[model samples]
Target: MRLSRSLAFAALFLLSLTTASVAGPGRITLPAEVTATGQVIRLGDIAVLEGPATAALGDLTLGPAPAAGESRTLEGARVLDALRRAGADLAAITYTIPPVIRVRRASQEVSEAAVRQILEGFLAEALGAGAADAELKSVELPGPIRIPAGPYTARVVPPADRPLLGRVRLGLEFTVEDRPVKSVWVTADIGVYGPVVVATRAVARGDTLAAADLTTERRDLSQTGRSVLTDTVDAAGRIARAPLVPYTPVRRDQLVLPADIHRGDVVLLVAERGRLRITAPGEAREDGTRGQQVHVLNRLSRKDLVGHVVDGSTVAVDF
Candidate 1:
């Protein structure tokens, strides 16, 4: 009877040794709060590795990740219970537990208009003066995109040419309140209108401009330069500096006042003050346009005098 009892006791002791060896002797510390990647809790993810944590976690398992905003707790008793389940020895091991666990979710649902406003502001800044007459026409979206509910910033990557008039494709980027995060490609349409001078017909170089030769056309002036002529009267009676193509926008510098006086032409030079008038016969020394000062040789005195051109054959000098 004594021998049988000794053998049974020895067997029980061996079993306990085996259990302790499987659990090991490392200690684990849990964090107060952590972000959950999915619906399952990972012991390794939250475990604070202060000392021998790796070895103590042998075969330890925490089942099913937490859902978003979910909470859990790990007290001293709970830590011991988990370790015991994993076959870790209680006497040799130590562990720390968090008072409470809180879940942090990364995404939220936001409205479509909020995003649209951000894009609109960004596009306006990108267009500069081009947006003066321009307006946001439409935004082509591919169904609903993934934007969470929160304050975010946006910017645009315009095409090689800016002030994108009409339809254009651009790159848009979004950031979570000062932190850069996401990007998307979208198509947009812009409506733009401004006054511009258009050639009504083909005009040869040096041709004197008439009202019928040009007209004002409302067109997309986002990409147009400010120097483009916008009024027909501003260009009427001016000489074309270059050949103009029909239906093309005319530039302000492309035309000048037509010359009304030619070199060597006979002109009547007159000086008048309060109806006191003096007239002289003069020969034009240079081509002169209306409002231009030109030199002329007085026939009787045979002296050169400067006079303002009044018409094709007349000049006025203030004596």
Candidate 2:
């Protein structure tokens, strides 16, 4: 009986030992308080120092390598490895984390509109790692940061050995605003009767009259000669405007003529008055009032001249 019992116990112990050794290949053994020691992996003769991690991995281990023509997710593996390297304390690590992204196309202050990139990473937790370093950066959280709303930059550094290499973040920024110009108005004189002027050219709101504006006539001639009289019409567009300046000393830049006048610049004899005789005999076709002198043809002279016809046959000259 004693011999049989001894054999049974030995068998059970052997069975327990065997069971402890294996669990579908993955459960790696790591002492409860073991400092991470990095691994030097070999690819043929080349060796790469991988990581120093205290991983408490479960039922998952390296499987067979992919066949020569197989395609795989490089981004996925890269992200996984990055996370694995980040959290060296393994037993505590459970869920997978979002990838750390480096954004290059972003806009920031100082560097105005241009091709920019903002590096970013999604952390399962903020980890609150403040800023990133030159070679690496920390991904910033989503939401508005800084001016000119846009991509926030950051970098990711997988923890090597020393004190969990800190994370870093930066924001892209810029400035902009709307600007405008000024508009002006044209100066003009508007009234009920239209632009007002006199024999004295109307005073433009802010203007000084000079010598040319005055008119004076001396050595009056009874004989009529062709001459021009300019005048300005009203808003009615009628040319019936009367002469503003008579014979006088029309000064230079003075208020002598109408504000506007440039028309039938010819003289004609029409009528006469008292002892003072004007242009000679002429047909009183239009607006030929008595005192209005105009041009008339002298039958003897056969030429047009200014004269006042006292009656049907009698005529006088204002020469």
Candidate 3:
């Protein structure tokens, strides 16, 4: 029975030694070159980890990652020191590391064409309803942008308190994983087109505008003033206040409503006081359209008075 007990104790001791040897000191093997996508480099990112304690040591942060499209070199001695500082058990780890390791941040190039497409989408949303006829004449980017390799989003910011028309600068912001990584400005030329009334033929002053004399055309509204006429019907039958050149946009200030009453014309002057009406002969002293007040010579009273033009031949005067 004593020999049997001794033999059992020896078996237990041998089993324990084998198990300890199998689970001993983790292995850390640094590669010659590594590509990192994250902003910070971790021990597991640049090195191949092995053994039981690797799970605890893999989370140790070494340092910041290289910039996008950039590379950094780290010495093996420095890496070991960093691991030690981060509470990694160096005594319980074995290393198969190179003297120096090259770490590059993986990146992608954003082409100019892609950037323009992004800007176009943003401009369309920014212009709202007016975007239907809006166009991007040209887009000038600073240059190609390099971003970290991952899913990313781009945001375009338009100039504040400024019209979207004409030359303007737009801001571009690039974000990777919800973190802003780069900012840049791009110049753009924008144009908004709309139909406008233009003189098809030269129109002399005081000549009534006809449909044959005017036509509607698509033009860049930004170059034209806001008061430009859009419909030929609005300008037709209206007298030209100034000579209009051919192919020029018709403005509101260039046309006037045809006069209903002209100067030196004989008209009926009417005076009303609470439905007590009186009519007398009068002469218009000036030309006036409907709803316009004009000077009238009252023949019976032999006096000049201001009266509202009611029609071609009738003028209403206050008693």
Candidate 4:
């Protein structure tokens, strides 16, 4: 008997729940202006529905919102169309009508981390091929970067513009899908760096380079062109063509090979043809490095002959 009574009570409880679900909520009241909490704005979310309206549209489906920071008005013909779609008998009901119903998108709060991520990616792209290994020095923004938060994306405004060089103001456009929402301007301190050879101390022109005079260091790649050597071996023993400052990048154009033959020095002039080799004492007319062509005066013949400097002692002359 107790079991039968409990079963009967359970059946009654289920019936009430079904009846309430079928009836839905009481008449919903819609304000003159409704702020949308999500992507879609529905009648159930924005309006107050009474028995008839509630029965007509248990849930009214409106289209998507206009934009993230914008609003859309639905009334008159639009409202009538929605009612028809909801299977409501518009002609039979004489309900109070308002001038218009406005649906607004709620302002979304943007986090600082989100904006920083965008700026970082933007600066990385500016590095081009070096982006993967490029190290950022510092990034600065003129003002707070904030935008209406939702499904959105960020990109360089012009797209075809040059990369951010040194410190400059940059423009980035934020979009929702394909629609543009806002543009943000910020200052960027971008730098791309790599290893380069730098002088350790001030050295005068014509001074020969030594290993202790140079050290490898990281510098902006933009300033370090192909003329800059990364290794001290290439720079060592080379004569300085210009005054090198301490801690400054050493460029290839700033150094030259030491001269092997000095001008006005006496050197042996050699002439050879297969096994026919002859030598004569001569004076160098101009300073020359090994393998360089220079004028040699034959001391006995008193004639200037062009020959290649072989070393500190010899200059090879033909004929």
Candidate 5:
């Protein structure tokens, strides 16, 4: 009698599990659904899509990590449009595959259905409902999932579960390998990027000019000259003190003389064959001999330096 009762209970448990499709720890719904015509795209958390990933994007790149409330996903416009724009050309890509990062929350607090939606939004791998022909294990979740979510990571869950619904923000940073890639989805993002001024010159190897890297049209260098066209990096874009450009890719910064420089005014000077020069403050006697020293200034660098006069303000020093 005990054995027969046990068997009956086992069958009941199995039936219950089948009824509650999205069940247990991660509550993953087996056989993820996909559409017949459309496929899904999963984006990474805050990321920068660059390297050879560019070329086609020109100056445009993705942000640090993919975001949740961003306009690109559900609308299917921003990222999808770019990839669709690329078509089949290997050089052209409109989408980027993100590393699947999973998220989990407390179970009773979240429901089965809610968990599924978050997973769908987070993974976004399956294609549209087909003749239900193809199946791909595109999404990877945290392994050996337990029952009842509690800080679960990289796992999928039911759709209705709310408190248990968490996000695994994916970040799509890729290093391309020289494989014979058939279909490529290059990472592309459409939104605000930089005025993210990066230094194109290094301080070493004779390219230490910060003035050219950062542009500022003070007083009279504007097209209309009404307001100074100050194109300087605001805090975030500015590189602090140290140089950050690699040697092979550096474009040297130039030292241009201000057209309106006045005599007896303190100025910066740079000579092809000598130390940077700066003029001394306060005027000397009308006699050319009175405290006569040639003060050359390096206008590119806003530093004050003095040098011995070769003749008047023309000074010589080795670079």
Candidate 6:
């Protein structure tokens, strides 16, 4: 009976040793404070793991990391619960240290000057070939921005509805690892220089513009409220609708097309009904450009009519 008891006791001791070897001498130590550089906090980030079984648990994700320039605290109990959920053998592992852990995410600041430089480059690219003569009058930023410590890309989004010249507002977007983190508004004043037509001499309202009457000059097109004529050919032979002073920019709206048909001139009145056409001699009562409607008197019928001016001497009428 004594020999059988000894054999059973020895067997039990050997089994215990085998079980300990399988579980491993696992140990975990938590620090009071930690810093994280990634987007998420991992077990290894806040805790030191010893032994084979516990070392593997270090890769387990704890939770989302705090935003840059910010910190968050985690409790010991919560961490233990997470470990337990991850199927960690609690009874076989030993833990040492803090009841709570504080974690801070590493960050960096984007300076105002850097932002201005970025916007300048963006503006230059937006202007394309015209950027060579473009001037940046002013740049306004919303101040510095803080973000996670890592490489990032910045994109300047211009307003799609209009051009980038004059006082313009743009959106500045920062993306890290292909994920958008923040956005800001930036404003700038831009001036684009280009040639514009200017009146060389005082031009009356009814005076026709001639090559000698207008000249080209370089000016800031942004300040011009109306679209200015760029070439003398666009203004030549066109009648002025408003009085233009010398050395002043000539705008497209200030000019009108020369009259094609004048009052009291004889015109060929044409009428079309189905495929049949009729023609009569008529007298125009009002000056009009081609395609303009004018009052006319048909000589054959001696009746008043309104017709579209086709040319300097022809008008079309509907019967």
List model 3 lDDT by residue over 1-319, tens digit each.
9999999999999999878755777778889899887999888877888897666877777778898899998787888888877777877877777888899998988888888799789878987898899988888888778989888899998888888887889998999999898888999888889999999888899899887888999999878877999999999999999999999999999999999999999999999998699999999999999999999999888999999999999999988
Candidate 2: tens digits of C-alpha lDDT, residues 1-319:
9999999999999999767544222232321121111121111111111233322332122222222122222233543464365543435333332232221211223221121132223221222343222122223334323222233233333224422223322233222222111111111111111112233443332243344443233321111111322233211122223333434322223323222211222233434467765443233322222333445554444575554434433334544
Per-residue CA lDDT of candidate 5, range 40-67, in tens? 2323212223334333443222222222
TM-score of each model, in listed order: 0.42, 0.14, 0.64, 0.53, 0.16, 0.75
Query: What lDDT tens digits, residue by residue, belong to model 1 across residues 100-214?
Result: 6554433444335755676678767876776677777778765555443356666778889755776778777776656555577777777678888988899999998899888
Return the lDDT, model 5, position 153: 32
Worst 10 residues of 2 by lDDT: 185-194
lDDT values of the candidates? 0.72, 0.30, 0.88, 0.75, 0.31, 0.88
Error of 4 at 141 (Å): 5.5
Off by over 4 Å in 2: 1-76, 84-92, 97-259, 266-319
Count backbone clashes in candidate 6. 0
Determine which window of 10 residues in candidate 5 has minimal summed lDDT: 29-38
Residue range with the least summed lDDT across 10 consecutive positions in model 4: 157-166
Q: Candidate 4: misplaced stretches above 4 Å?
A: 1-28, 37-40, 50-64, 90-97, 109-112, 118-187, 191-194, 218-229, 256-319
Clashes of each: 6, 58, 0, 7, 60, 0
Off by over 4 Å in 1: 1-119, 122-132, 135-150, 153-191, 265-283, 290-319
State in Å the error of residue 116, model 4. 1.8
Q: Mark the regions of model 6 whose C-alpha exceeds 4 Å error after superposition.
A: 1-35, 46-58, 69-73, 86-104, 297-306
Please name the candidate that would achieve the greatest TM-score relative to the true structure: 6
Which segments of candidate 5 are over 4 A away from where they belong? 1-139, 144-195, 204-211, 214-232, 235-240, 246-319
